[model samples]
Target: MKKTISREALKSASLEYNDVSGDFNWIKKRRGPIKVGQKAGSINHAGYVVIKIDQMKFMAHVLVWFLKTGEWPTLDIDHINGIKTDNRFQNLRHVTRSVNLQNQRKAHPNNHTGLIGVNKKGPKRFLALIQIDGIQKSVGTFENAIDAHNAYIEAKRKGHPGNTL
Candidate 1:
């Protein structure tokens, strides 16, 4: 496990927090003093904000978790709104991997049906399915994608934690 930094140490390091954006600003001595409320951290390849401290990289959301709760999160830090860059405290939560996947975007770029968990079984029919405990369970087959998606949604609501819809 990675070593966790304490809130006191983080504060003493001259890292200022913006409650509104849930970001941390590092006061670099060479860059001169930064303006108050200025946002810091760089967007990583995965779209998450990363801050470097003492040569160690920390995710901004995870840092926010530690700053707010005074302890490291035991589970995954999920962006509740599904926007990876939106690190607002109100839009973040600690949830299991399964729960995090449940709240993902409705569809991926490769999805041809334009709906999650729904696939075309025939020219006019669609099949709805969901994964529970790593097992795929079929919800049912329907004439339209909407019906199939509804069934998938119903199954997700029943089996997936933190499901909003």
Candidate 2:
């Protein structure tokens, strides 16, 4: 199993965090292509930044949270703008897993309507659905997808964990 990393360990390591820009710079040279003062992370397969320290891989956003606050996050870190690689301190929020999922910037790939929670109900109506406390609640039918989406956003504003609206 991989060992759990601590904030103090990262603070003493070779990385220097740039909170405003969300960039990590190498503070010292290391073996095999790593150089002093170079950017210290790469875009991972999921589009988030990942950096390797002492053979252990860590998400750059997590590192930023750790370094900036001096406390490892106990919950999910959300990128408010939906760009996973953008880890600027102001863009990051420490939230619950539900809130993290709710703040997504894009509709699901399988969503045919191109708007989150809005689906075609019939020939001239749309359905709006939202998740609240693990329940999929229907908001109501609407004439257009935008209206349905607005209903969903309104429901989210009420109490949905994401509250990104």
Top candidate on TM-score is 2
- Give the Cα lDDT of each candidate: 0.82, 0.84
Q: Note each model's CA RMSD in angstroms.
A: 2.6, 2.2
Report lDDT (Cα) of residue 1, candidate 1: 80
lDDT tens digits, residues 14-102, model 1?
A: 68777887777665442545554456778999899987776688898998888888879999899987888788888889888778778
Clash pairs, candidate 1, are none
**lDDT (10s digit) by residue, model 2, range 1-165:** 534578767877788888767899999888889889999889988899998877788998888887778777888988888889888999888998878887765688999899988999898899999877778889999999999998888888786645665
Name the regions of candidate 1 deviating beyond 4 angstroms: 26-37, 106-109
